[model samples]
Target: MVTASSLGLTERQAVILTVGFYMITALIMVSCNKWALNTIELPWLLLWCQMMIAVILLKVTHSTGMLKMPEIRIDVSKALAPLIAINVLGLGVNTLCLVYVDTSFYQIARGLVLPFTVIFAYALLGQPSSSLVLASCFTVFCGFYTGISTEVNVSQRGVFFGIFSSITTSLHAIVIKKSLPAVNNSSLDLVYYNNVLSMLVTTPIVFLSGETSKVMATLETEGFQAFHSFLAAAFVTGIFGFLVNLAGFMQISKTSPTTHMISGAVRGVLQTLLGYFAFGDIITTGRLSGIVLILSGGAIYTYAKDKEMQTTTKPTYIPMTQQDVDGNEDNERKA
Candidate 1:
């Protein structure tokens, strides 16, 4: 069987893979969501579809034995309620941001997520951060202000939605740590529950939003091409959406919240650059500076965290086998 031990991989390798999975999936999911939302003009319904599609895909994967679904339990569902609530709200604002903001501006719009996460963590979880981490958050806040001040095409509503998302996101990250225990610390189970509950909540949201009516009206007035495009984009994003969910939990399980924030900062940089090329987004000096400062803060934060971990970490002892002892004794006599 394939395993990390057989491949001689350290924890760092696993960290890289987990971070990579999130970065790549997030980048794709955001772009696809932007397309799907634009083409459909029904954010709630589109999100509902994505959630349902993700659940279906999960079920299919479970059937194939690639992953097993935990049986539905009332206790687990109740424990997951808080997470599901935040997940729905967070995603709702995120889709709204995509609807109203430029692809490149997306990162700047949501840039406060890290700082907010730090603040929420300390306030709610009673986890204190180092001085350097606090300084990094200050730097990131500066970058956020810089970009917002200089951007001429900034969307006021998009910024509002982004701020709301930051709040939900901070809460979501903290809540996940608490909720994971209820799922036996299994990322897959959490993913399953999150999507399933989201579907239940979003079903009514779609109708209450009047999005279903809008979709049907548009379909009757427009050709099939746009509808087909929406479907395709939704499917692609739905798959990555599930993968990103799994990746998020897997990463949170293995890394500190600080490290996860750093990875997200890295992702923001890459996402900004890609959005520039993919969407032909206008890049200004101020915007570029914001990206730089954000990335620099993430670097500083990561270094401080590494240094802290090294000092606080205890070393492990590996016992040698009898064969190794006999060989060492013979070598000592020869010497």
Candidate 2:
């Protein structure tokens, strides 16, 4: 069992605390992004700003020497090129979806990620999945259709961006897996390197999107006060953006992977409710039913995957590095 050694908390206490914080950070990141983009009207610029803040936080955290952060080098750039491209695309599309969609409809919009992920895994990695997984994907598909069909004032552009984001998200997961070798298989390093590369890509886009003109217009119309308000919102969103990743990492380290995934399902439910109360988002019967179906499918998929892992007699990947070997030992010990 994982313990909060510094806090001297028992395993259950630690798990609850860690998972709760992880869920909260995830929720805040979404809500903050929605709030920031609501008035900003500049998705590319906001993305650039958030990535910049995340990069700064990562550098500071890496420099503190408290955590074992991988030393980023230039050599890995080529290896991470594909992932970087997908990361930028994914972030851009997700931001666009946030800009165009309501907070309550967000999950249903991205509900296709599971199906896309399963499809990509099979296509790219030649991995075989069980029938339960396919059934769950079908359920997710139904949920997405149910939600969109019932929206009284749905944004077609938002739905398009959302679907594109789902594809990128699923593609990104596979790309990240394949690119892990470039970062010494350290997820922390991947986050650091991804932000750095994504920033390089988004900086020019910020200007290309005419965000500078928008900024100037706002300043001229509302003065520095309005500009400062936007900045404050972006700053808060950026902090949560980075913290959400750290929270997820901490949750995984402090509990089993199963627990982490399960918490995500719960977090989605809470996010739906949070959107309804916090943002005056309408929760129609169809929307609510769609969300329930999606969540149910996701939870079942997670369970099926976990059971598949437990019953499988063979390991998937060959251990290439000492790190991989040690990780294998640790996983076995935990089990």
Best by TM-score: 1
Query: What TM-score fits each model?
Result: 0.88, 0.84
Candidate 1: residue pairs that collide:
none
Task: Give the per-residue lDDT digits (tens) of candidate 2, residues 193-220.
Answer: 8788889988888888888998889889
Off by over 4 Å in 1: 1-3, 6-8, 310-335
In candidate 2, how many Å is residue 95 off?
A: 1.4
* Residue 20 local lDDT, model 1: 88
Model 1 agreement with the true structure over 1-335: per-residue lDDT tens digits: 33334577654575577778888888788888887877767788778878888899999999998988988899889989999999999999999988998787878888888789878877986768899989988888888888888988789999899789778877876787778778876777888999998899899988998887777787788857658888888888888888787788776655545556667777777778888898888989998887777777777766766666556534221112122122222111210
For candidate 1, the TM-score is 0.88
How many steric overlaps are in each model, in order? 0, 0
Tell me how far the alpha carbon of residue 238 in candidate 2 is from the true structure, in angstroms, after superposition. Answer: 1.5
How high is the CA lDDT of each candidate model? Answer: 0.76, 0.76
